[model samples]
Target chain A: MKDGLVVLDKVSYGYSPERPVLARCSFQLDANERVGLVGTNGSGKTTVLKLIVGLLKPTSGHVRIFGQPCCNERDFREVRRRVGFLFQDSDDQLFCPTVAEDVAFGPLNMGKSREEVRRIVSRTLSLLGLGGFETRITYKLSGGEKRMVALAAVLAMLPEVLLLDEPTAGLDDAAAQHVVDVLAELPQAMVLATHDPRLLGGLVNRSLRLTAGRFTPESSRDWAANPAVRSARQQTA
Target chain B: MANVIENAATYDASFVPASVWRLDGVDPRTRLIAAVSFSVLVTAVDSLPTLVAALAVVVVGAGWTGALGQQRWKRLIPVNLLVLMLLGLLPLSGGATPVLSVGPIVVAREGLVQALWIGLKANAIVLGVLVLLARLEMASIGYALGRLGVPEKLTHLLLFTVRYLEVLQREYTRLWSAMKMRGFRPRVDGHTYRSFGYLVGMLLVRSVDRADRIVAAMKCRGFCGRFHPLDHAALTVRDAWFSALVLVVLAGLAALEWA
Candidate 1:
């Protein structure tokens, strides 16, 4: 019942009922809290985000976003509007033929009047410092540029909560720094799930580790104290 | 944005069915056989009624496969109208006794009927091909082609074409966006056409460059000329039986027509 941005209460999820990937996973995020979720491969980090977005439903327990139950179509829809999900693979998320079209997709799909959608798209592109990238073909974008375009597209949606899955997954030092800077500047509750530690430096005050398909909260200091995590986090920093 | 999310939440993934046709489940070889069989049967037959019947079979087949949903059917309705128009025009190809005459238009009943037949047959062919392509990945088709006497190199070309289309579409989209940002508007003027030609020439150059980069990447990953599927599809008992059933049904339909 608390006014948390995201609340997962003992939720268990798996693609198949017989085999559970996320076992009784639970967590909560308050407004403007930058939380990091770290996990090894297949540790259900990405699955957690999908569950919050209602891309996958829990087999048991519940997930509440903005204090409303998350699984219901209506609530999930509202949560989606309030939350921006940056899918790990920008290729799948960026569906429009052109950079401008891709950024405009979420707005257009929302079906605002033409002029309003145009304004929103233009504003988002300029905000991302990609003002004239409207006509640029999405496929022609370099890996770094594509990441920026993807970020710009999500920013255009203007969600209250941003769930970023490895925003710096495939980028050089400079590109990754740009993304980190953008994340730092954004003033919203964010749950960043990443394998990279540098993206976590100075941004997150709390850390949650995904081990054996469940989240365990640890202090930001302890997360940074871990030599391995520190080394990975420092790379992007 | 909240409103949009709410709308998307109401959306169900089930709206798009996972399977497209019988070929969807069958082994690549079997799917290829089915596609080849259907394509050859439809093309070889000169008789209008036979072709019409073949078209009906494909149409029904698509529906049965659960591929003929709202989107596919929506595309078909407009196409059906255009086909009707074509049918109307066939009889009026300056034939004698263009039966019905409207202002500035004459309808030749025979030509019109013939046109209808052609249109129906064409649609049938298109429908069958779509089902095949929808269910069977191009690699599977390439494998089938290789199995059925197609040279390794030609099969490779088809595979490249299929993959290239996706890449080209993405490239074209980016290029179009770039042009749009520069306030480029498409016009019917000569300058527009000239720019369009240049765009196409650029596309070819980009495709070649992309292909080289991809080849290099693949080489780095130790890729050979051949790609082995993660799941090697084979003819199960069910697939064999399904193929038999299809052959029997098609033969029965053909016999009924003969009778």
Candidate 2:
């Protein structure tokens, strides 16, 4: 197996064959790499993430995770087991009745023993400073707390590569800052699709831009000119 | 008072606190066993006296859990009234041994006894359902059902419904508010039905759009819809003992009746 984390070779995808959402995009990640995906609303940044996670298959290309083709169910499941994801809407990601159950979901899905699952869930909760909230109903949590719980659930899965979609949206200044700090401290390689400048600032060393329907390299300077980007940066830093 | 009982048995958003419930004291499985046993034993009693005793036990149990708050009683009254009315009308139908006669109305002894038994049985069943809900939360119920050989796809659907019901409700409220802002009102005539039809159509469209976005998001996160219950607290020795005790007590009562 190759040492690289992920490899997408000339991948092309679309909802319908006539309308290609993502066109022949290719990208790769190495161990401990931090990459930021930036694009407009209709751009195919989200599509790329879906393809990597095997949610959507590319029309004609290959997506490899940990050196293996992520096309079959067995391959995708193996990849999914080792990759934690933070979805755009916190509500969509969190579906459990209680905070603890939500956080323990991924670990449980991976079929860990009961004791180990409990320990990992508790540790992740406390690490996020949510120690006294095991039994709290998930719906009753504040937006920021819900985000933390969502991340904690994935962290419990203990993935090697983490993918986040707008992790800081709806969070207040303090909560967003806390999220930034938490993301920075993670040992895993990360690919963040975000509009939060604070989350993308000094933390991510590489930036991938998606325009119209293709992937291209971009710089921090290019990202600074956009009004939406400016607002997100101001909110964070 | 009526509202109190209703709130206890029904879904109340206010009852769900921000903090998680502790699973330390009693195993949910054991509580489930106890609840099922109690419900069956009480439901089997044909005598009014035994039925009343079962209802009392249920009430006491609810009280111990602090679930017998004002909300619980409020909910129970309407159902109680309905049961009363049904039983009251039963004596009027056919044969009657008139213990008391008032003009055209005859209150028969058998009818009175039968009504008491019916009320007792109804209360016992209601109490049992409430206790089961409180002890075995939705997640555990889903897990138990899944373990009992329910199909994964159906279980996922149930789980999705549970998760998204609140989201759908919030969306519906927002849609209603938007309609109200536009001076939309329900008329008593046929126009009201047409307007309602329009509203439902819009709701369906919105739901489909929301579902699409949700599916996209879930796919990005590697969701395949086969849910596995997380580190569930273990069923302890105490749990077994309690379950056995409940079963034994109910069996003894049943045996006595048989003898």
Task: State the lDDT of candidate 2 residue by residue for A43-132, as single tens digits.
Answer: 887777777787777888999898887787668877887877788778887877788877777776666777887898789999888998
In the order shown, the candidates' Cα RMSDs to the true structure are 21.3, 5.2
| TM-score for each predicted model, relative to the true structure | 0.48, 0.77
True contacts kept of each: 0.00, 0.48
Query: Per-residue lDDT for B158-252 in model 1, tens only?
Result: 75555456556667768768987988888989988887787778888987867664443232222335543222346698778768976975685
Task: Give me the candidate number with maximum DockQ.
Answer: 2
Indicate which candidate wins on lDDT: 2
TM-score of predicted chain A against the true chain A, for each candidate: 0.90, 0.91
* Cα lDDT for residue A57, candidate 2: 79
Judged by DockQ cut-offs, the docking class of candidate 1 is incorrect
lDDT of each: 0.70, 0.73
